[model samples]
Target: MLMFSEDKGKVKFNKPLYGMTGKYTLAEGISLPYFSSLLDIDRAINELRIAEQVPASLEAKWSLKELFQREIDEKRVRQDIVKGYLLDPKKLKFFNAITIVLMPKGADDKILDSFENDSTIPPPTIPWEGNDVEDGQWNHPNARIANFGGVQFISIGLSARLRWDENRVLAVAVDGQHRLSALRTFREDQEFGRSGSLRTHEQETKIPVLFVLLHPDAGFLNVSVQANYSIRRISRELFTDLNKNAKTVDKARELILDDKSINAQCVRTLLTESTTEDIPGLLPLSLVRWQDDFNRFDTSYYLNSLVHLNLLVSEILELKDKELRDPMDKKQVMGFIKSINDALGINGQEVKDGERPLTRYYLEDCCEDEEDPHTPFSRLPEHYLDSAVEGFIVNFRPWLLRLLLDFKPYQELLAYARQYNLIEGNFGKFQAQTSKHKNAILQQENTKDSEWNKREILIPQSAINSMKENQWAFKAIFQKAMIRLGRIIGFEVRSENKNLGNIDDFLNFLNGLYDKGILRVDASLPDHSYRLWTFIALNPGNEKIKVNRAVEDRIFSLLRLWYFGTRKIQIDTAAGEQILSNRKLLQFFAADKNRVHWPGCPEAYETLRKGFDVATLYRKDSNEITIEEKKELVRVRFSAVLAAGLPVLSQLQRGALHEQSSEYYNQDNES
Candidate 1:
């Protein structure tokens, strides 16, 4: 039996355990003695139990059990471990320690009968064997107890061998439950040859473990002592200390910290170099809420958050289809990256570092099988990344920035803020104060009635009210829809198409509608039934804009039809026939057949009615046309319509910016 004791000889344990003993000082007067060891795979899987399986009495006291450990994610166990680490066990390595709390078996267990029956069971004592020992009563041969200025210290020369009875104790893992679950799953899978079978030698793999004892008078230890705190209380404190402080990286932080993704690299460059002389960034650092996951309704000071911006960058680079967790098709991804580089005017020869092609910029074999390659810019030459970032700034960034800035509400908000001096140079500081202002209003207590409540009011009430009034314009979904519209109309600023004529006309028309309150999220409007925004964007039930892909797509299609009709784009006979017979557009326009009214201007409705007449003519002789022919005909008509509108759409004048110079603020003196 192995034995261990504290330096002052206040606490001791005697059991058959194979590990080194140490004490972790939690506070000035409180410390927990721990046993660190490497347990064989089989032993750890069998011996250790999760906190939920502990005896009812012990479980009841540990009210923090749910908070202490998370439910084991079975998907993580199967995919990340069984399919990842265990796929090759010979080179397996797990550096993290599996932390477990040791509790003595309850009174019901027969294993603890000896300790319970005997009121004074003698603690197992081991004699020191070294000649250097004076009393030969030390826990270790090379141990020495000394006093340094009234403080006692004990030293075990190299390592302290500790022992613990495995059967008489209950072991519960407080941390690394996922890893433990993975181990258990791997072992079970090995027995059935499910996930690559492990050989006999591989099955004996050992993992690091840390066993902690919360109380000195633990029943199985057969020792009696008094302490200020119970085992359950200490266990709860330890669990909270471990988990509460360990922060999980949110989406915004992940994007900021990412060094591999080309999309992330571009986003970071834009945010950091917002005021670069050569190509001024459209997305100012101050306006971006990079720390937030989603834009809060109450906090409308920022333009957009990191998550949406990253997605936009991906869409611009044609990398939106691939997710970070999805398996990499290296060859396909490399080809796509090469195309993006070519379009950006990066000939791969511009940047030095062996003067390689765009495809050769990144490492050929930087990742393992089944792992995501992330982006072609990952592990690329630093000079090439710089060139790539520059290319995006010059070619792609301007168009996207223009598209976002062209939104009437964004323009008006910026102008209003500038005119009123609501925001100075530093956007981050202003955003922080805005958050404080929101909090003060929410908490409604503790905040004094002095300038403490008004000191951070950088954004005036007028700007806030304006933002709240046009809330739909600042929505992530709305911006995403705009980007999609830009792509559809071939206005995605590229090297070849520098002129944003077509996109400008479309925005002006949309903004005109916005100015007339057609896009307002109010179901009580007199023209609610006839409003195009109602059918396309706003949810009638909630009187709020529906923020989903389906709604976004419908918005694009309906807008495209309106734009084409307004521009009077001509279509071929066959294609025109198919467009008129388009049941999707027909159903959308005539949602309530009882009231035969179109949503747009009378001129546009007349144009649509004339087109519907063509469908009537085609329907009389429609028996001859097949379904496939009809689909192809409709696609041809849509393409022709977009092409015909392009020239005239670009020639249309850009819309003038509108301004609202109204200031309204009310303060409450109630405290």
Candidate 2:
């Protein structure tokens, strides 16, 4: 008999189990022993189950394959582990604890009876004199078992050994699946004599394992009855939570899961509550890719990725890099306010030297830490962090949404998608379709079948290709450019700057640009004389538009000049002055061959001339000059400027611009 006991009372058992067991408290205040043990590599590979192979239980109607565990990469198992770790057994090889959930295969009526009766069974005591106990339980002098508060408690010392019967429980991995897979591969290869240099002793190595047992009262073990909480759902939730908290997880996943980062939390709120009545989210989840951090939006159906969206949110809220990475703090809040004031050109009362600056913006109440002035900004109190996150979301959400929706291209795209039934009005169907599309793509990739590919085609291929060509409006660079411009406009609106126009005026200006084809991929002059996009911001020959700081700044400057003209809003900054005064524009046209013959050049010059007082081509030095002389002078200056800005010939066009000057230079060099 195994002789399992409860509170000094011995109870005989048919099967014996072993491990070092102790209580661990969960979020719901349910305490259970997370059993820890070391198992031989062979036994672990055979006995333990991954999510993909978990057997069905009466409590769970569906399979555990729906868990968020990533599929194991065979190549990684072969190269990084089998070839790297096991091949070098001489070096110290260690593995982290593989977390597993030990779920009962079926309901034990006795345990259910104990829970139903609300039993308070006393702890069992073991006689000190025995080596007569079960083989593994002999060393556990202090081990005791009891049933209280609808949970069975098995208390034992850290060094004590308790038996684990693999037949009675289903052990499914909640974390470290990849490591387990790699070990299984290594074992298989060793058996087949394919493991190059792994020794026989290495195959007998033991790995650390942690077995989590949920409280019996949580209803996870009551397999006979249907309930809200089940082993499948709980285990899946645990898997997701574990990976989401791990440092090795990707940033995009972190943004979706991180509660500590205010920026990330705000992003989640925007995505989840996008269609809510209180907060109308303009950027639907269907239009945003929340998976990988790659910025190749031009090729995908998504307009933006989560990483860039987080960055945009951070920028819009004026969050510092440190704040984005860490928790928001009072010091960071102060800094953010300072930045806001600077953006709006709000110069508060000047402070004297050697004194703290004036608090121009309202500061939220927070407990002050006087002990350490340089305490980490992330260490702010919980209440303060909560207040900060809530305040930011409430204040900035409307502005951010309006800014995104006000952009002409975004509005047009939304309307078009809605018209084609590609997106739902309330976004409910769109989200479901997005999830279906993602799953279909995954299935297609995994199966390598064209049938799966058909299911994955949510959007028409022709439409996708057209969107790719017209991706200029949806590119990250373009979105960021709009955000930067919107930031200025938002500040002007909030500060009630006189030069700031109403929403209608802003809309009209954007619509005018759209109508002129300036925002299109093929934006150019009427006769295809010159590419207007090239003259403005885009590189001459690039296919995909990338994030270029210089290019973005140029775009902002040009838009500000054209939209606001030479008013105070346009010429307030040095950059604005340079563009509006025609100095920078003239220099740009004179230097860049691509801009001299641009159709907008003359209009731009005329705008500058009207905005600022400047001399014409004719000099006022000689009054004796005739009207024809003035005309000749004007023509000569125009011809010289045009000639200076002419494009240089390519190697293919080498003899295309043949000139006598070039021939004379050649003859002089030969002589």
Candidate 3:
């Protein structure tokens, strides 16, 4: 028991708290015990002010936000300590230890130097007096020690004298702020105060702490910081050096998980503990601190990569405080996680068997030395993993989904057109020709088996999986696809002319097109078309590509519908699933790239003329054919065009296509 005397300014302890005992000598004349006690915590909260506040003159030198942000997140700190009790009471225990520094006010420079450097110097006189004046006396008025038989308490001061007084702040907090803040806030909250668990123990609660006594010289203010550095569990520089559940990491995670949005939920799941029932976590259950961990060379790459992806999603959906109740939105958001897992080859079986997961592979591969297993991702020579993540989110995920989803309304329109027997000509022949033209370009680029290579009407699985192997290739394909669609659709897509960094800003630009009547939104998938057109037109995937025409690959497979039908086009349901898998249309595009514009070239009209000529032979009335008859002609004619390998529309025809779609383009561009 450590005892504090109210009248005489003395402290006496019979034994260390929790029966732990250790001590260190500062100077030849002075030494302090490694003490832990309930009284220390109570005294720290009531008596201590941070070192920056002490000595008054040093206050201006320390920035409040920069120096003490640990104190600002009080709610998170409170949740951390009480969360164990709240979630499972049986696991509750003292979360962390408080560390305090005893620095007396205005000590002599020489004496302070001796303590600071761990050099020996003679002891000063004691300030405390016992019942017999000669029996207990030690240092100057700034410090003192009193002994009752074998037990002793050393009082090193932050105030003028080694005394306990309300007017003087006595100690400086070196560590364990989260724990202290939680304890203080729990007592203050009326509800928490009434809680039986906290009230049950009261002052009987004991925590372990390490304390250091420093000389009260201005230079020794840094000594408090030194004490903080000495703690072995925290390594502020390298993330790999951090303990599994560091206080800082825990606090950040709790703060993020507190949100309830679907977007946040997805992020929460990624940062949650890996389980056999769910996907393996890309991030640790307890996240690293952004402020400290971000600046560390070891942790910054992966931390920012994950955080930036979350930011991208949140920005697109406006996820803050917004719950996604719409089935479509929910499906899409959840699918985003599933796509990532599939792309990364994440399997629950592998995780349950204790196999190294995909996320760990990338992180480990990037490290400088494979032999040093402790610092898992401490030395990434190049940030390839981060680039891969960015590429997946920006290029493959959104772009692929756009092609699949935007076709919904078109499919509905095509079905309506088919039912009424109002179809004209062999537009299907024109669509197949368009697919050939696009696939030729992809093949030219040496990208075998790509969406373009297969003449895909939907996003391909190869496109999604390729992101892992070559993010740059995916980036190139994405940029090229966008510019091609923009030009083919007659939109003078100027990447440089847009505010293209934020996903939301780019989406707004697409909505402006809808507002202008150049494009239409399938009310069921509101942001689909906006995402599709802008994703390519704005070239949002690759930041390295300047918004220019040079990167555009003239492979506009998405333009097939415009030449084939004025209505929205629909593909077979079986094909849609085989192509899109779990991907949602919102993840891809809102409307068909074909719906926005027609290729204005003479070559396009020429091809349509041939299709019309073929359909004319099958018409009931010379000018038109029924849906069934039109389909038969289209299938036969388009197969012939594909086999014959005729040019669909060359770049030479680009000028003509631009002229044709110019009116539609201008309507939306101006709006």
lDDT per residue as tens, model 1, 1-671 = 23343322432343333556677664555556666778767667766776545655554544435436566676666655555456544434664888887544544531121112122333334432224243233555566442211111233643334333333455667777788877767767653374544468866688898877554432112123233344444455667777778777777878887654567777776554432112233555555676567643324566566778887776656642343233246766555555556544443333323456555544443344435554332233343555667766765665676666666776776666565544453333445445677575635622444443343454354355557565556667666656765654442432243222366666775686567554455523221132234434664445466777766665555454555444333232324643322223322333334122222323232333333223322343677876444433433333233222233332333210011111100100110
* Residue 35 Cα positional deviation in candidate 1, in Å, after optimal superposition: 8.6
Q: For model 1, name the residue pairs that clash.
A: 16-164, 17-163, 17-164
lDDT of 2 by residue, 1-671 (tens): 23344323322221333567666555453454567778767667766766555543422544345664566666556555655455554436788999987555423311121122223433223332245455435435575554323223355555333332232345668898878887777766654364544357865688888877664532234333334455556677878888878768677878876655667776775564332122235566666666577655566455456788787777676644454342235556556544433332223322211232323212212223432123233222222234445555555665666656656666765555555544443232434445677576556565886553443344432354466575456667766766665665654354465454544455566666666556675565332233444434544446334357755654554555445432322335534443212222333322324232222333343332222211223445456667545534432332222222222111123222222233322322232
What local distance difference test score does each model get?
A: 0.50, 0.50, 0.33
Please provide, for model 3 over 1-671, each residue's C-alpha lDDT reduced to its tens digit, 9 standing for 90 to 100: 23333332322222122223345555553334444444444444445454334454433433323333333354355443543243334444555666664432223211011222212321222323344343233344644443221223344442212232222113445566556656655655664654423454555665555544333222123333454432112212112222224555433343364332333343443332421111222332212222221211112111122343344344333322233232224343334323334332222221111344434543354223533322222111122233324333433344323321232322333243333322221222222234576556556644654444343322222322322232221233332343334332322222332211222333333333334333321111121222223222233333223333322322233223232221111232324533221011111222234223322322332333233344233535744666555544433333222211112222123233223223332332332
Worst 10 residues of 3 by lDDT: 581-590
TM-score of each: 0.49, 0.46, 0.36
Candidate 1: residue 486 Cα off by (Å): 2.4
Sorting all predicted structures by lDDT, with the top scorer first, yields: 1, 2, 3
Task: Tell me each candidate's RMSD, in Å, in order.
Answer: 15.0, 20.3, 22.1
